[model samples]
Target chain A: MEKRVLMKGNEAIAEAAIRAGCRYYFGYPITPQTEIMHYMAKRMVEVGGTVIQAESELAAINMVYGAAAAGARAMTSSSSPGISLKQEGFSYIAGAELPAVVANIVRAGPGLGGILPSQGDYFQATKGGGHGDYRNIVLAPASVQELYEMTIEAFNLADRYRMLALILGDGALGQMMEPVVFRDKEPIDLPKKPWAVTGTGGVRPHNTITSIYIKADVLEAFNRKLQAKYAEVSRREVRAECLNCEDADILMVAFGTCSRIGRGIIPIAAAQGVRVGLIRPITLWPFPSDVIARAAAQPSVKAVLTIELSCGQMVEDVRLAVDGMKPIAFLGRSGGNLPTQKEILQKIMKMVGR
Target chain B: MQAVFKRTAGLLNIPTHYCPGCTHGILHRLIAEAMCELDILHRTIGVSSVGCTYNNYEYFACDMVQAAHGRAPAVATGIKRVHPSKSVFTYQGDGDLAAIGTAEIIHAAARGEKISVFFANNAIYGMTSGQMAPTTLIGQVTTTSPFGRDPDAQGHPINVSEMMATLPGAVYVERVSLHDYRHIIQAKKAVRKAFRVQEAGLGFSLVEVLSTCPTNWGMDPPKSMDWVAEVMIQQYPLGLFRDPKLEESK
Candidate 1:
């Protein structure tokens, strides 16, 4: 039986990481996500894990990179600006195929955007925020329970694929308190990382982890191999949830907190005779394109509406997923303001000619 | 004297890709010889930095990781923390270390990360074909500094070892030159000491080796060495700046 407790989303992620065997954490303080660091700092020491308050976002991400290269399950948390500073390290880690978890409790941003809740970084999160041809396994958590669940899965996916895994949340998700069940009380037995730099006791040769390849041909080959791994991930790892889409006329697409809002409006819209259905993407990067296409193919489905807290970032992905089978519309609110149920309801009403 | 100059055991026996008279050959030999003497050949992990020697993992018999340019120190810090028993070191060049990776090295040393950094300061960016480096001396000309390195406009040369020694985290810091036989011998000693400090469980250690780049300096091999000795040494002195062993002795 899983132990159930009332916790904030940020706290659940911190506790779930401990349960998932993350022994090292490096992060700088950032709004809406600072509680995760604070919780880990207190709890990791009790569990004999290491938690460091890094000097800067760059230092924190590099520290995570270091620990990941050493084959330790390490993580960092930040908002938009801090995450931008971490892109260089993230790119390097992805290029090197090092496993690590990054929690982005996203806030609105072009620059120093706001501390309020917003889903403005959909493109940056799913399409690779860093330089180079690489992708992170991006997990979108809608609630506190999902936060706990997704963070643990993020570690597992990162380790299995040897790539960066991201938990993409917003300020609302980070700040919201809800009940969560903690799974696996027993110490997790992580897979033996043979590639890690665990000291050579004269029993084995030394190991080094880096991304620099001088020969252009060799570097190109390395890139191709990484691409192959990504392709494999895409085939095997698409995750999403369809709520009442079977007989629905309008399919509403959203993720993270926006999905929760969209879910809330589903019954209300149904009562108003809108017949709107909701499709929530659990994994944003290995997007559920197949599911979206299937939803779009429905003859009764009028249009695909994508709702987010940004100026239409995920709409492009929704458009790509629908592939012109139906019209795609976007309703966005930016600069830390989350869309209200009424606003989303109005958008759906207007779209369906109600 | 029947071929006393044989390849080290842990080094590949293939011909090096370095240009004729490149100091990388000398530096590689010095590190390999130190590893052999210390009996840590099997337990060493070399983190190769971005530069001409980026693919140095191919040469070293031990396990190797190629770090992003300037991020070797951070990578080494990670490897050392996870496997404290392993001998972890980063081989970095001037551009990779002094310019791009300045924050990483400084923070690693400041945090007292238990790793070693072998800095190859050739004054110019050799791998990029003679661009001006952070350590490029005043009035020295390179591809980017065609009109001579204007000290007034472009900052003065950075003395990395001196800067690092000021940090409380560094347990060993030294600057050595490979411009001559005497300096080369001293340079080897400095490299050995840096490794020993790490082996003894001391904090961050660094050895900045003043080397010659004949191709980038646009001089013959011998003249490059002479230029390094005469001009480079005057700007960047060579000596041990910090040693935890000496502190304990005092």
Candidate 2:
């Protein structure tokens, strides 16, 4: 029987990471994500793992860089401002092709915006906030259960692809309490990291992990290699869910907490004798552009409504996906505020011209 | 015939890209020698810091990872924590460690991270073609400080060895120069001691070697050596600044 318990999303994610064989965690405190670090600090030692309260987010990410290079399952977590501070290290990790798990329990931001829930980091997270050419395997969880499942999946994907896997959450999901079931997962068989810097022992040639290539040809080739990997990921990984789009006049697009609010729209729209559907993007980077495009091409769908906590971010991606085929409307509540189901229903009705 | 003096196997038999008269080669040799003597080269992981020696990973015959600027200490902390029984060390330049990575190095020392740090303080950013570094002397002339470093404009040079010694977590702290053969010998000893301290599970250990940038300094190798002894030593004195083992012995 799988163990079921009531837990906060942040704590559940941390516990799931431990169960997934992550042995080292380095992090600093930030609102909405502090519980992740606190739980790790208390439990990692009991499981024969290590946890460190790094001096800063910069230090925390670099520590993760080190631990990953040393062939350890390592992770770090932070909020908006703190995640911004880790961009440099993220670029380094991606360039070096090291495996790591980075969690951004996002809050509103252009700067030190607020401690409330927001998805304002859409571009920064998907478009590579760090310098150089790189992209993270960004996963968005819409509930505590998804948070636990995605946290484990992130480790597998990171090790499988030898890339940085990011969990993009919001303050709402991070702080919300929910009943979660811990299922026994099959043991993940990760590839042996022969290139790791865990002592050469003179048994083989020395291994080096570096991103610097002074020669233009060499740097270009490295960039091409990264592009090939990303292309493969896009082909194999894009994940999203569609609901009630078989015969609907309007389709709604959202993710994470916003998607939960979007689900409320389906029931409310039905009672009002309206047809509405939703498509939640679970993997935001290798975004489900094809699905959205195809859905928008359907005859019954008149428009696509994108609801987010930011003024407008994912809307651009939605537009890119739809490519002006149908009218794309956007509704967002920024500055750490969340929109209500009534507000969303009202916006849906307005877009449908009800 | 037997070998009287030969290169240690700790270093790969590759011709380094270092400029003539640069001490980076000498520093690499000293570290390689120490690793061979300590017999931990096989179990050692080296973190190479950014700068001229950013690619030192090619020269060392051990598992190596390149770090961004002064994040070497933090990287080393990560490696050491994962493989505690294995030795971990970082090779960083003065500009990388003292200026950009000050927070990383300071906090690593404060946490008493069990790793060895080999800081090469040449007082100028050699890779970027002669910019004034945090360790550049008060009146040291560089591209950025054309009229010589102005105290009013550039502020005073930081004495990292002296500053780092104040941290309780630093178990071994020493500053040696590589201006001449005799000083180079002392530097090798310092490098060995730094690694030995790590071997014994001591806290953070560091050896700050006053290196020379002959190309960036616009001086020949010989003249640069003399300038280091005659001038650089005046602003940055040499000797052991901290050693907890010495304290416990006393």
Candidate 3:
């Protein structure tokens, strides 16, 4: 039987990771996400797991890299500035195709912006922030329920794709407390990892995990194979939620914490006699562009109002998805300020001439 | 009626790609033989560090993972923690282990991670050509230190083994040189001892092998060996610096 509990988003993610068989947790304390490291530190030891408070964010992520390479379920969490420190390790993990979970409870960015919730890191999360041509499987959670569910899914996706999985949340989401019912208490049946560095034991030949392909042709071949895997993921794993867009005039595209605000504005716009629908992207990387394009093809959909907490990061993807068939407008308040439902409704009224 | 020359039981018979008179070949043989003798060859996982021997995975007859520059220690720590039943070790070069990977090795040791570290100190970066390394002698001249290593400008050379020995978490730490046949034997013993400590599930063990880079040293193979014994040893003395067994006796 599933148990109901009142938990913050950060605590929920930590619990979900433990129930999902994550045994190693390495992290450094940072705002809005410190509860995750605190929770894991107390719980992991009780369950015969390991929790390490690394010296720095750089050390924490490398510890994750180490644990993941050893075939253990591992994770780390931090905010914007801390995540920046982890970029090098994250890139190496991605390049090696090692499975690990990184939770970014984003605050304002571009150098220690603020400690409040912001979606400024949308571009960094989607586009590989470190050196090299690589991609991370980014999962954007809109609520406490999603914060728990997506963390489990993040581990699964990371293991499946042999890549880093990011749980992209914000300060508001991490700090909010809500009722959450776990899916099940059943033990997770992880797939066998034949590629991990868990020793040979004479059962098989030695396996090497590496990203250094010096020869041009060899590296080219590796890049082609990686591209193929990415393509497969994009075709099969793109996910998003569409709310009441069949007969709507304006389509509102948002994700993460911004999606909740967009959802809140939905009824307000409807009461004002302005038709507005919300399209929330669940997976930000293998983006749900196909869904957006299909919605844009509808004759009733005239414009896409992209609401975010950044200047215009995710708005670029919405514009690309809409493909100029409909005019795309953006409304945002960065550096820790959130757009309220009243502000969103006013923007919709201005757009629809209500 | 019997084979006069045969490949070592644990070592792969493939001819090594190391330059003539390179000590890496000898070190590999020692590790392989140790694994075979200990009956842990099948259960051993080697994490290869970034350097001239980055492709060491091809040489070891065990599971291997090639880590990014300075990350092998972290990788080995991961593998060891996950599969405690398996023997895990990292083979790193002076530049890879002592310079770029200083933090990684230091933290791994401080955490008392049960793994073996084989630090090959040639005092120069061989893979990238004769560049000055962290362990490069104070007066040494290389491509990057053509004016000779200036103590004020380039900083002083680091004694990695001695420094590591001071850490309380390190159960075993030793410095050995492959300058002569006798010292080469001692170096092999040190390597084997480090592996043995890890196999016994003791805390972090490290063996720093003072080696010679003949091509980079601008000397012939034999002359470089002599230089290692006569000069390198003067700056970086070789001997056991820490041993858990010694502490137990007291």
Candidate 4:
């Protein structure tokens, strides 16, 4: 039997990252994300790793860039305002083609709105958060166990694709506690980064890591290459969990903690004489749009309802995915407010005319 | 016949984009000579910051990483933390280090990151065509300070070495120049000492080189060199601001 340990979502992700061979962590203090930094400071030292409580988020992300460029599995985590500072580094990392992981333990904010949980960064996560024609591999984990697993996978996916992978979580997911089991992962044989700045040893020609391409034509070519890689990721990595999606009167779409709310609405709506189903997205970047299209295409699914912890962010994706196959309804509560399972059920029942 | 001096392989023998008589070329050679002398080129990682030398990564024969403006020191700290045995350094400019990247450099020094920082202080933002700089002399005129820098309005020029000397983590802080043949030789020696301080893991080491931007300064090559000696040095004095070895001897 595997040993079970109770840990906060942030700690679980931190421990999983260490298990995934992330030896360097740079972070700044932010509520709901500080536990990850604390865990890394203590545990990283024990495992012969390094963790720095950086001076600022801007400094932290740049440090991650340097470590990643030097061929280390590096990571950083922060809440909203701090993630804003990281945008500059993310753009450079994407342009230079380095691999790294970052987690945004989101708090309420347009500008330091509050420290409570919020999922207002969906567009920022799915679209480019930084100034560029690039996107990060964004993962949305609804449970602590899933958060742990995805944190480990984020490293592998980042290196495999040679880009950034963002684990987008809210303050609630970061603070909540759950029993997590530590599973020994099979050794992964990732390809060595021959392009990294691991000193030339005087034998090999020195490698240069940079994001600046002065010529317009050269930069365009590099951008095209990034687009092709993103296309491949979309084709290969779209993941969603569908529950009773077929033969339902209504289908609901959601992600992260709200997706769990989307699932609970099932039983409540069923008891109220209306059949409802759900599609919980795992990879928010390579969004499971096709899954939504399929579920909404079912003859019995009359309408699609999208629920969120923000004022209709993922609803935009659902609208894009459903593509007029079914009429869509959006129900959201922004500014640190979460709609209850029963409240979501009422929205679903209203769609089904119950 | 025995070869007395040949170019060092620490820097590649490639043409640079620097203007004629620009002091960046001289500073680059001094750093290359130090790398060759210390036998650390193969294991050294250089971080090139933004400015005219943003692309210096291409000239350095050792592995190089080009960092964003003002973030080179933080980046170097990250590299050194991971590869403590390998040597790491950041080459930055007045605007990049003293102005935009002020926080990063200050924190890196405060933490005593085991890395070397080679600062080139030319008193103006040459790449941007002579904008004001944090280390600009009080009366110097640049595009931003058209009527000459007024101490009351623009604030006093920052003495980088003197400020660095106050930090305990900064084990070696020296202000050098390339105004003439004698000063050029002394500047090379200071560069070597900066690298040696890092080699000995003696915390953060910085060597601020008083460089020239002749084109932006609107001066002829020789006049620019003379200006550095006769004018620039008055505000940024040439001397060692901090050295643990000197302290130990005392």
All candidates: TM-score of chain A: 0.97, 0.98, 0.97, 0.98
lDDT of 4 by residue, A58-106 (tens): 9999999999989999999999889999999999999999999999998
Model 3 chain B worst lDDT window (10 residues): B241-250
Off by over 4 Å in 1: A185-187, A199-208, A213-220, B1-3, B246-250
Considering lDDT, which of the candidate structures 1 and 2 is the better prediction for this target? 2
Query: Candidate 1 docking category?
Result: medium
Off by over 4 Å in 2: A188-190, B1-3, B246-250
* Native interface contact recovery, all models: 0.55, 0.86, 0.72, 0.77
lDDT of 3 by residue, A247-345 (tens): 788999999888988888878777777778889999999999989989878888778899999999999998898888999999999989999888888
Clash-forming residue pairs, model 3:
none
DockQ preference between candidates 2 and 4, better one: 2
- Separate DockQ for every predicted complex: 0.50, 0.86, 0.64, 0.83
The digit string of per-residue lDDT tens for model 2 on B1-250 reads 9989998898999899999999999999999999998889999999999999999999999999999888998888888999999999999999999998999999999999989999999999999999999989988899999889999999999999999999999989999999988999999989988988888887899899998999999999999999999999998899899885632221
What does candidate 1's lDDT look like per residue over B1-250, in tens digits?
5896777876767677899998998888889889888888778878888888888877876777777778777767666666678888889999999998898899889988888889999999988799999999999999998999998898899999889989989989999988888889998888888788888888899999998889988899999999988899899998888878733321
Q: Which pairs of residues have clashing backbones in candidate 1?
A: A206-B63, A208-B64, A208-B65, A209-B65, A210-B66, A211-B66
lDDT of 2 at B204: 91
Error of 3 at A51 (Å): 1.4
TM-score of chain B of 2: 0.97
